[model samples]
Target: MARKSLFITAIVAVMVLGFAVSAYAIGPVYITWNAGGANAGTGGPHQDYRLTTEKCAVCHSVHAAAVSNAAAGEFGPDPIGAAETQLLLRSSVADACTYCHITTNVSGLQIYNGVASNYTTDDQYGHNGSTSAECADCHAVHGADTFKGFIAGKILKAQGNLVSNVSGGVQTEAAATLNTLVSGGTVFTAPAASDGDYQVTAFCTRCHKTFSDASETTITAGGYFEEWDGSVTFGSRSYKNHPLKAAEATFVASGANYSGRVAWADAYTCRSCHAAGNNRVSTSYGGPGGLVSWSFPHWTNGNAQFLVSGWGVSDANIGLGTSGANTGKPSGSHTVMDGAEDGVCLRCHTNGSSGPPNNATAGVNVTF
Candidate 1:
């Protein structure tokens, strides 16, 4: 009798546990299918391609392409100029990009470089008012596969000159040649310096010729080498920059905050310091009228050199005392950072208050 009672209790407990498990089970997520509509399939802002022909309709109109600037949408206000070459919604390549890439657009990434949604040609902060390259110049709308010398993949359309091959410390350029942006949508991070080609870095150097390792010899320019071993002298002091791709152990002595400050162990990368998001707005650092006003596209501020976040030093704040640099005001002419602290540099180098002494010391003054 006792054994039977114990068995019955065990069976009841198992049944209750099983019911709980079944109730909390999660189902698989399904991608929405396209049914002959613009951007109808599994396409979101950045993922606006590859699913169906309807996606192309989002930018192109077969016969009913209007001439007036209609309101914004997946099929927004039509282009203002004459009919585009390939049924594009906008007459110019940059106009079509600005149409959807605005903040008020119904869908797509908002990479507008102006205060308002419309195109602001006088934008002085980032890469907005350029007469040179347009949006289509850098990225492939239809996805570049075979048009270029090499496909960097992920929709990056190579426009300018870039280092195509890097072998045995030798670099080669593919000038005006085609190449694609490397990596896919899901995972984007700074490739290690040991990554032979430094594909992502090479992609950026396509236009920003000064930032490539290939230009290190002739050019004392700002590139991978400049960040790793170069020094930028400001006023009376010379500052050493953080290494772009160095061993993780180099920062082992930095302290517990080191890991938290940098997401990757291989130090900083182009993407590590630069990215697009709401936090990178102009007002966050300073308003448009303020000394540190910023614009998007290349993520640069007035005088901040396009740092993702930090105190931007304008001509007004260049040679100010600690009170000036700390308060964002200009006063007497003083050397840079006369004991003044900056949030940008301090993100990695602590203020020597907590654990280890700050590593940003150079003889006397703190050099970022």
Candidate 2:
């Protein structure tokens, strides 16, 4: 009887070992926001991070799903089947994001206030249009092939194809195709400390095509794009217009007189100058005026017209050295002024002994 018991124990051990090895071989499983948790069906305050499970029911169900296409409804039906788009619980990708992103309750990633203000009202604040903007339009919920910031598709391509891909034209390409066209186009699998500005520019160029063209020279229209490019050369010098991507690297390496107030290494992205709660914004911008709760780059406080407080060109406090206190709110227009100190142009470029080349007070102006 004892020998029989020992033999059974050995068999059981082998089965358990085999199961563990098989699980390890399968590798890490990725989950989404809506599935596999104690709070799965409870709704409203959704989880901030992804869960781990094989259940697609988080965002979809095999049967008894929602029937309505209403924006306020919890789920929308998939006509084809549950497998199609994974039987998405919402009508569309944008709706899924809105279900949680629109809120005044500070629990979830609140981008817009559903009760007070929303994306529909503040259309100019982000990538909104007559049609509701899709979150998947800009971000890949699962992952991207070449980009690391959860970018949805490829915006970087050969210089020849740059305009076509960005100007409301091609939009995105497959990872393999994108890699074949552009050098160093492989996805940055690892998370980097800084949001890649080069990639960020490509992302923005998808919609704002004319403003991102590097070859543009009109000074009135295409100049903004060129200025952001920072690599454009004129005569013998590479014009450092506000410094981005490699141009920023050159500036920082040159040991130019940076304010040392903002950490330039981390503040190189488009959001650095534009997002709410940025260090550059003055505290006097007022309550909830220049403040956005979510950290995502696409969202910002409605005030200051998307530009941080201290950086507005038309602020009543400009040149008064008052930091725009009680200066009212931003116009929400893209208008910029020449040689304006209150705007973002002077945050890094001041005449505080740094002198010319790096300092804008030496005659450089970013107004448009």
Candidate 3:
């Protein structure tokens, strides 16, 4: 009887364990550092704590949660009537991301360099506006359905009349004209036959619509959308604006300079050169602006005026010259390309030199 009782107890324990596992499998998966697991090892955020159980509570609370005031200071007296949205611990989405991403000294994912106090200065670029510094504006904490890196959404709608079209000497279209431009839809997926270019160009145009249409008079300078639409001629030269939508196979075969420079199998996106570390210069280029330190395309070394160093100009005269110099490069009141690593251009252009030759005639011999 004793043996039978022990056997029955073990059987009941196994049944309970099985039910618990089954329940966990069918439960909704929440967004956490490691998907609500323990430590996330190398590529994940290096935090001592884990989201073992309560994932949602990590960022949100039901009642009486800690409130932070950015104006008064990060940690100051809580106001009598101050309240956070969705019961978040911090006052805003930007604050919440900065609370951990900036404050902590985690190893794998320390983004303290990317956070900016405000976007009022001229040097401060990228998503500059009332909610410019908000991380939630570009990324979704819950994850994204259309994009890989938690990108919020495509097809950003302008709130009000922001741009006016120009006719020869007069304004043609009014700010009320709502222009809808298409962006590179999804990134890193298998290339399609028709529109397989990387989506970064389109993604950026969603916000800066004035640059997407050449006919729009809102912007006086040449429009990037028209320049890189794969139809514009490169001066009188046969080469077109560095092919953004061309297949990797065709790009590699085009020339030896492109060999082994980028992942040829993948589609070329705007991030190829605009991304952090791609410039081969100090990750933190602009002092307080600190543009290049931000993740992916959000932050960039204004030194290159959003152009990734070593590559040819994205727009006209936007990248480093063959001589690896920014001395005379024109980029809207900012002198980009400090000539730190001008050889980065040789990655694609079959020019002159890559290393210390550092002369304007070093690589590809282009006089941009």
Candidate 4:
């Protein structure tokens, strides 16, 4: 009986060892957002970073092609990588993101990095620029929801009042909250009442903090002016500024065209100008232009302002004034003063004047 038991134990040990070795050689499995098994039917809030065990291997190698660095939880001593150790497949964040985003996946949808042909122009590239931004700069790779609740899609790291205002090397402003945005949809609409402040606006302000300040004086107080929220008496002209944050009801009542503007979920957030390419379905401004068709705060026709397309020198008859619409042809000149009645502006305000609207103008100047 003892001899028989010893023989059975040896056979069982061999089988287990062989199975482990086979599993190790097979590489790692990749799971889609809606794959079968325990993770089937999982939604976006918890999809990318939660319960999806296979997803981790897609980006990271547990035992990378290098000596192990047990201290940093990564394979260490890799000459071509970072010291802190992310164990990324590619050396840098940009390369890894562009590897997938730059091309069309099996789904046939290009999310971040468009095809090379479509993104040929200077303004066509947003965060894809080599020096501009990386995927990790915005997105949370290993999952942002620490408390087992849905955060926003693309997993925005912070929301609500957690705006970043770093000045003189220290964060001068109050630290903004984290993960307050807990809603997701085709369009990033309003969240639950208890979620937080206007998340999209606050998220943008994390980098573009100048826009968050209420006063232009404070925004440009350093003597170098940044005309983000409209300027005050700079270079002999005053551009009519739009409100960055405000109640949608009040803004619509104050008169700027909200028709076909999708980002106006609850308030006039930063997304009003800087949003996804397809969000603007309005045909008012000679259909959507190429520059506007790309995501904002990234691609901008080399203009640096990141203003959407239709900003070119073309007259658009928006039926704003009692006078007939400008429609086609230059009713106004292309001089710097009038901005040639750019269609980008007309997309919102009725054609106010031959020149940029003054503070007295009711169409562009709506008080919150």
lDDT tens digits, residue span 310-335, model 1: 22222112211112211232232222
- Candidate 1 clash pair list: 70-77, 152-180, 152-181, 300-306
lDDT of 2 by residue, 190-235 (tens): 1332234335544454443332112222212121132333333222
lDDT of 4 by residue, 1-368 (tens): 99999999999999999998987773332222223345333432224446534455544555453332333223321233342333445234444543333442322223333453333233323554443445565555544532122224335544322222432111122122223233532112334433323444444544444343122323321111335354422222222234444323333323545532221222244444332232221121122212232334444223234333232112332111112121111223122222223445543443234443332233434321
Position 117, candidate 1: lDDT? 26
TM-score of 2: 0.44
Residue runs of model 3 more than 4 Å from their true location after superposition: 1-53, 68-86, 105-108, 112-133, 149-205, 208-267, 273-294, 301-304, 311-350, 355-368
* Candidate 3 lDDT tens digits, 1-368: 99999999999999999999987652232233442244332113322234454445445544434453334322322221244533445345435555444443221233324454423223423333243434555444543323322111221222121223321111112111111112333332213322222333333433323321122122432222323432322111111233333223222443355443232212144443343322212112111212224333333435433444433322222322211222222232232353235433443443332333433342254432
Give the per-residue Cα lDDT of candidate 1 at 321. 19
lDDT of model 3 at residue 292?
29
Query: After TM-score superposition, what is the CA distance of residue 145 in candidate 3 from its true location, in Å?
Result: 2.9
Model 4 misses residue 192 by how many Å? 5.7
In terms of lDDT, model 2 sits at 0.35
Question: What lDDT would each prediction earn against the true structure?
Answer: 0.34, 0.35, 0.34, 0.35
